[model samples]
Target: MSDAYNSSWFAEKLTDRSIRGIALETSALIRAGALPVGAKLPPIRDLAFSLGVSPATISEAWSELRRQKIITGRGRNGTWVSGDSFVAKPERLASVGHYGAGVLDLTMAVPDRALLPALGNALVHAVSTEKLNSYERSRILPELEADVRRTWPYEAEAFLATNGGYNAVYTLIHALVPPGAAVAIEEPTGMRLLDILEDHGARIVPVVCDSDGPLPASLRQAMLSKPVAFIFQPRLHSVTGQTVATRRMAELAEELRDTDVLIIEDDGLADISDAPRQSLGRVFPDRVIHILSYSKTLGPDLRLAVLSSTRLIIEQIQSYRSFSSGWTSRILQGAAAWLLRDETTAEGLKEARRLYQARRDNLVRALAERDVIVPSGGGLCAWVPVASEPFALVTLAARGIAVHPGKKFAVQPTHHLRVATSNLTDRYEEVANAIALAASGG
Candidate 1:
């Protein structure tokens, strides 16, 4: 070890011995220039011995630092002060490569702007919402709750409105999951989901998925780790676009029956997916938390999503939220409620679903004609198997097209690309040819 890894000096600088304390003190030291970037940290055992604390404490503190990107390296390589900053980058989201001008970007799994329902009338109706501008935080508008309840998969004990689907997931996880706790989520899930889990330092246990949805056997094996929660897209998976069949839902519920783990069902596609919404919430009402997002069906600007669970869990998430925004924008919630209840919006949603499915089908059929078979699941994107992620990415870029690498959405290695088909309104054959070529690493 170099003189920079002076255990005695480092130990003296750490007055607080608790995990949080050690992490904070170390961060302060690095920011204050006491520990310069590139300086190697003392080994866990040596630092713990010097500070009169357990090695576990030192290890956890280091883990927190690593999560914040303040330190780098692990195991035999030795830990080093990588940076003086304190921001935790969402690794997966950041890794989704950027595209330049003229590149046909098919990376983001988002709804086509042209298909989104008009929000003008909804916003106009929102002006009449009761207690419109009150400072008092309301968990959700009464009208909104009633509208959501009419379609809720179960008789939820309570409901809480949030900024959007991702916000609801992030808030709930932050409120319930402690650092390093295991969380089982569907494999090849939305990249944003993985980002949230990693940002909170949760040990992500991937539940592998098949065509019907998450495989029960994989979920059972993941449960062996005793994860705090099991999250999945029930209606339509945002990544693979596969819907969890009713039978699969029952099997998943059965696999989780013995455990008290929280069940989080994210219905991200909302009305855009034709599949009937399914939830394990009906089976385990007290433990299940269901989130329904209208971003795709209505408009992303609505910034509204609703979550339902037992009053206790809802209250916990609301309390955590109080520390920040306190409450979601009522205007957005009211607009969403208006849109949900409007007949015109209903028709628009039906049309949007038809159009998106058509786009997805067109891409699938086009690919099939070129000897590339991809699942025609319902969603804004399609997962296409590839010979190599890197080679496929390079091949697509060479053809002025861009797509997300499958590795961005999975914990395990995957050779695939997530191509956005929502806006693939025309030239399907042309784009499909490029994709098929990329898939074959040509």
Candidate 2:
């Protein structure tokens, strides 16, 4: 939190580019860990004078860095490095367990191959027709933004796209929840989401969930600490697949009424889920931040998502993005727009939804018959409760079936395993047998 930007580093690293060149070079340095944490940046005016650029250029660069959460400007106190927060968190494959050759890995909760549209074709179609231009002209591709607004489930005043679902969630958190402030989140939520919140230095107040999603009582308890924000995974609640019931959504919205808590809704699975999409956003229009991600529909590689809410919050996130990451990849945005809007990916979308629902329903039914309880929250993953989670994981692993332990998803220790059904085709019988055997110890 100390001001640490020095002019000497920029002087040595400046390239042929102007103010942006300076910013980009500094960002590179930050990424390389050359600019240590707590390092104070040179005063904006000082840096501008040193670089022989207008103060406005330096101001623009600084705005970008601040929006990205790479640096924090404290006005008279001075600007300091906050780059450690942006350092990419290495994927925790070790905790989740890596797969060996020939192992049936169903660990990641992602859409099946049947689900992803012909991305290559869509990208080609988009690139061939659309004129390439600088994304700097607009933070969002006009067509994609329109499509997002067109399909948005809630009555949002405005919309903004982020890098992905996580980034959208991160932007909401970074924008509203200050460091050390307690923020309420679902107990058994997305594992990566928990890591993202922790990384941003927020106090996680866990609100335990049932098959119906977060209980009203637990949420009421969480609100007492006067949390700055609350993140809810309304539909396809990760390991559990628990969507908040319509009645519960109303009740929760009522409780949040008049409260300052910003509701961050991660509705990334709406397209693929069999369950009807319901959101608290409609009830609490002013308080809700709705996030929709296309990775589950298109493919994870696309990494495109949008955040919708009131204009103020959208503008704040937009402002941060404008200065920091600038805009989402135009090529990716264009391809997504073409795929979703055009006739090309329409059949693919329907097939993906139908096939995933079938797989999830069958898995849930099969597990229920085996006395292993897990409800299909209309998602790709089923949460199967086991007598002994460790033994079941070992047994299943021995059977060459790799699954993610449910403990990873929960704030509390869990006796359940999240079974991913993305690749369960002919192996449904075999996989079901392994899971039943693992759970029953028979």
Best by lDDT: 1
lDDT tens per residue, model 1, 1-442: 3576577988778899999999999999999988899999888888899999999999999999988989999998899999998766788887777778888889877888987878788889999898888988899999999999998888899999999999999999999999799999999898899999998989999999999999999999999999999999999888888888889888998999999999999999887888887788889999999999988888899888999999999999999999999888888989988988889879978888888899999999999999989977888999999999999988888889989999999999998899998888898988998988889975
In terms of TM-score, the best-performing candidate is 1
lDDT (Cα atoms) of all candidates against the true structure: 0.90, 0.77
Cα shift from native, residue 247, model 2 (Å): 1.0
**What lDDT does candidate 1 reach at residue 392?**
92
After TM-score superposition, what is the CA distance of residue 166 in candidate 2 from its true location, in Å? 1.1
lDDT of 2 by residue, 1-442 (tens): 2333456557667764475676677777888887877788888777777787888888877766775678886678888877764544524333777678899898977777655777787688567534465556355677887777776777777777678898888777777777668889988888878877766667789898887788889999999988999888887676677778878787777778879898888987767765666667787888788888888888788888877888888777777666577667778888888877867577777778777778877887777777776765667788887878889989998988899877777667878888887666656767777899898744
State model 2's lDDT: 0.77
Model 2 lDDT at residue 79: 83
Per-prediction CA RMSD (Å): 1.2, 9.7
The alpha-carbon lDDT assigned to residue 317 of candidate 1 equals 98
What C-alpha lDDT does candidate 1 achieve relative to the native structure?
0.90
